[model samples]
Target: MFVKVVVVFLVMVGAALAFPHAPVQQPYYEQQPLMPYEFGFGVQDKYSGQNFGQRERSDGRAVVGSYSVDLPDGRRQTVNYKADKYQGFVADVSYTGQAHHPYH
Candidate 1:
């Protein structure tokens, strides 16, 4: 019994020394810089009846934008939106003009 216990102890010690513990490593992350910008674009084709416009600006902390499109029903749909770290995202939708339907 004594010899068996000694042999088990020696085997455990040998295994521990044979495979040493590896040093732990922490994860690494790269940070990117943010820049402020503003841009607006629009398109209008009277012959094809396609009209749309969008304007947006970002100040690094918050973003605000509005887009308007001429819907097929003759009404124009406008959507105004804003987003930020504090407020999250919010949008207001509105429409203008009346819809007309032609019967065959």
Candidate 2:
């Protein structure tokens, strides 16, 4: 019985060692220079790659929202937003490349 237990323990230890695990890398947010066509799953910005914007998808085939980005020429492009990453309510966005006035 003792030998069997030791053998089992050793087997488990060997298996664990053989299959070393790695800590998962969390998705990181990155910044990009102002440009065109940037997109992503959880963040938003100009320069289409990993900076489009973040969204949650919750329902059937689609998610919807909006975004905006500053053009290098100073004009801002306002865009609609939608994400298939999860499907749910996201946020609204608008762009104009001008400073926002906070009070009515």
Candidate 3:
């Protein structure tokens, strides 16, 4: 009986020493910097009859942009847009000139 008790105590001690308590960990987060930028681009191909352009600017809080494309009917379709945290996305569309259809 004494030998059995001694063997059990030794086994418990060995287990306690093998597995130590783990320390609690806290979560970490990273912060990013905000930057302002603006850009514009345009493309015009006379052979392919493709004409389009776009311009945009952003100041971290709000964004504004405009784009225009030539329609197959000869009218130019233009769109002006703006977006922010409060009003969300808003756009205005307009057309210039008149459409022409050629007979086959």
TM-score of each: 0.66, 0.26, 0.66
Question: lDDT by residue for model 3 over 1-27, one digit each (tens)?
Answer: 999999999999999999977876554
lDDT of 2 at 61: 47
Ranking by TM-score: 1, 3, 2
lDDT of each: 0.89, 0.54, 0.90
Clashes of each: 0, 18, 0
Q: Tens-digit lDDT track for model 1 on 1-104?
A: 99999999999999999997998665442144446889999999989888999999999778999999999888999999999868999999999999877341
Q: List the residue pairs that clash in candidate 3.
A: none
Residue 60 lDDT, candidate 3, scale 0-100? 75
C-alpha RMSD between model 2 and the true structure: 15.4
lDDT value, residue 57 of candidate 1: 97
Off by over 4 Å in 3: 1-33
Preferred candidate (TM-score higher): 1 or 2: 1
RMSD of each: 6.4, 15.4, 7.9
Model 2, 8-81: lDDT tens digits are 99999999999969987655522323222433454543465333334333244455545555454455666665
Best by TM-score: 1
Rank candidates by lDDT, best first.
3, 1, 2
